[model samples]
Target: MHDPAAPDPNDRDYPALMAPGARDLDALDARLVDCRACPRLVEWREEVGRVRRAAFRDETYWARPVPGFGPADAPLAVIGLAPAAHGGNRTGRLFTGDPTSDFLFAALHAAGLAALPHSRSRDDGQRLYGTRLVSPVHCVPPDNRPSPAERDNCRPWMARELDLLGPALRAAVVLGGFGWQALMPVLTAAGYAVPRPRPVFGHGAHTRIEGPDGPLDLIGCYHPSPRNTSTKRLTPAMATEVFRHAARLAGAGR
Candidate 1:
């Protein structure tokens, strides 16, 4: 039953809604999945789901915000720009069912972070060890570009997720410049002391931010997008080394 007079949850302030919570990661994830704070994103994601791509016309799309994936106490975090419109936005899991996942997971497996070399679907028995995959924006934006407003609207979810991860999250591998820029502020908000000028984003770039518990290492890596990989801007060896470096920094083993 629908209540016509009820205030729409989508219209509520998201950051405020998440502020008073003392819940665990599961609770946070539950709330995150139902968010429709951005009208443009809400309309776009749903529209894509309804129309769908030719190959997936018969399949159901997740259509909602995608949640972070991995164990609650993962020592390493892998941050990306956002869910792919036809990938995570359709598969219900970040970095699943796309060329990006194919390239990234294979690298992760080689670095001893993931159990499998591919992440095709949510229930495919794929697993990550001592690592979690998250993105700055949960909803897939049009043309794979999210507006600054949309990015800000989505910040609270990532902030809360990182807060819940807490001291256990020792290191992060940020893929691409967009994610690198987006994550800096989130790290600062999570109580890490970011540098005055802010560190620049470059492949193989590394910095350490002092957190309440200890120093957290940040490593930059080229996004494993089809464009980058196909052009050889980022090679398999380069990607694997970045993950391996982050794993070592986080003290995570296979």
Candidate 2:
């Protein structure tokens, strides 16, 4: 099992695969492709790729790490669950070209947070103004839901994203009950304590705490999945209100 003179067979040369002159997003995409840190995730992602390949060969699924949804220098971060089978995994943009994205983008537009009203593709005439979206899990799971272990395994990437944004970030809006539950630790680790008022995680709850770089505010909404909205668990208005708070935190709200 141990050979001192030979290069290890399992060792991968990560630098070789990186895109030439790639700085942030390109490098991030490359790193996401070979992510094997989580054994089970890697296995599952591979399986999805095998079967879904025929379903979306021309659509061009990400088939790798789903990159963050906004600017590298954004001040607001939106955290959510993994890619949907036909959403992010298919279109390569977080919440882009999907049913939920239409509702989410409409709200962002109404809140004066995003530059575009319709988000159909990465190069579409839509963009987040001072915001970004990063999921707890980067890959598309079989179901929309991720296992607890899977959620925990992906926390480091979220933390790393926060770290990357550093001083530019002032707040994060967690989308979904599960999203809020998963983000508590990351916020705490970043020195963002509960606000004096102890902001609740409802449609319009806004909380601000001092982070190492600057103030870190937060808003929460249940995810905009069809099931959530169709079943009246998360209404479009509720999600819009949360985004409005995020806009205020980012200094772009009405």
lDDT for each candidate structure: 0.89, 0.70
lDDT of 2 at 202: 70
Q: How well does each candidate superpose onto the true structure, as a TM-score?
A: 0.95, 0.80
On TM-score, the leading prediction is 1
- Model 1 Cα displacement at 157 (Å)? 0.5
What is residue 148's positional error in candidate 2, in angstroms?
Answer: 2.5
Off by over 4 Å in 2: 1-26, 53-57, 194-200
What local lDDT does model 2 show for residue 142?
60
Model 1 CA deviation exceeding 4 Å by range: 1-7, 19-22
Maximum-lDDT candidate = 1
